[model samples]
Target: MGSVWMYAPEIGYGARQSLVGFTVEAADGVIGHVDRQQDQPGMQHLVVDTGVWKFGRSVLIPAGAVTGIDTEAQKVRVAPSREEIKAAPRFATDSETADPGYLSGVGDYYLSLRS
Candidate 1:
């Protein structure tokens, strides 16, 4: 019970560890479903599963480790992504949590890129 509360509604990624088919919803609408993960040097991009409207080529999401997911709202909100989702810290598939030391340096670089 205690551990469950840690990565849930409150904050941070839940105990669950997997982003294969995790949905990625944006403003206008459910942008697209996560097709694949790319862990680069500064940010992690998600390849969306779009039929024909191939707009987003791996939309950049924060590396805060994908905190909580609102199943009802159908939204995948990350901590660092709020401000600079496109430039949020990058995280590898093994990343369990966001690092504080590297956050400030990012300086919300991707804030303007938000849709």
Candidate 2:
């Protein structure tokens, strides 16, 4: 299997190991702030708390979806549109992060959108 390369910095390239508490923006607008991030090489992801935007629901966004990270602004940019994210499989529980089946579903869903 191939590793899913996470966000690619538009200006240059380097490893950005953390993103907790960074606000996330979709193609159209800000979606939420990242509450947590996974550093796994193949399965990087961000756990975003939607706050009042989605009635406090949390979404797990694949790192591949991230476009850039602005450390100064404390923000992360993602490619998926707001609607696409809202339609993605929900990340409701902490344990779900370790479930291969659930992760596969999320990966498949985003992959489908790319095609």
TM-score computed on alpha carbons, candidate 2: 0.88
- Work out the TM-score per prediction: 0.40, 0.88
- List the global CA lDDT of all models: 0.43, 0.81
Model 1 poorest ten-residue lDDT run: 1-10
List model 1 lDDT by residue over 1-115, tens digit each. 1221123335443334445576665443454566665444344534445434444333434443345565555456544432233434443333422443443333344343323
Q: After superposition, how far is residue 92 of candidate 1 from its true place, in Å?
A: 19
Please identify model 1 stretches exceeding 4 Å from their true place: 1-11, 14-16, 38-45, 55-57, 64-68, 71-109, 113-115
lDDT of 2 at 85: 93
Model 2: lDDT of residue 102: 90
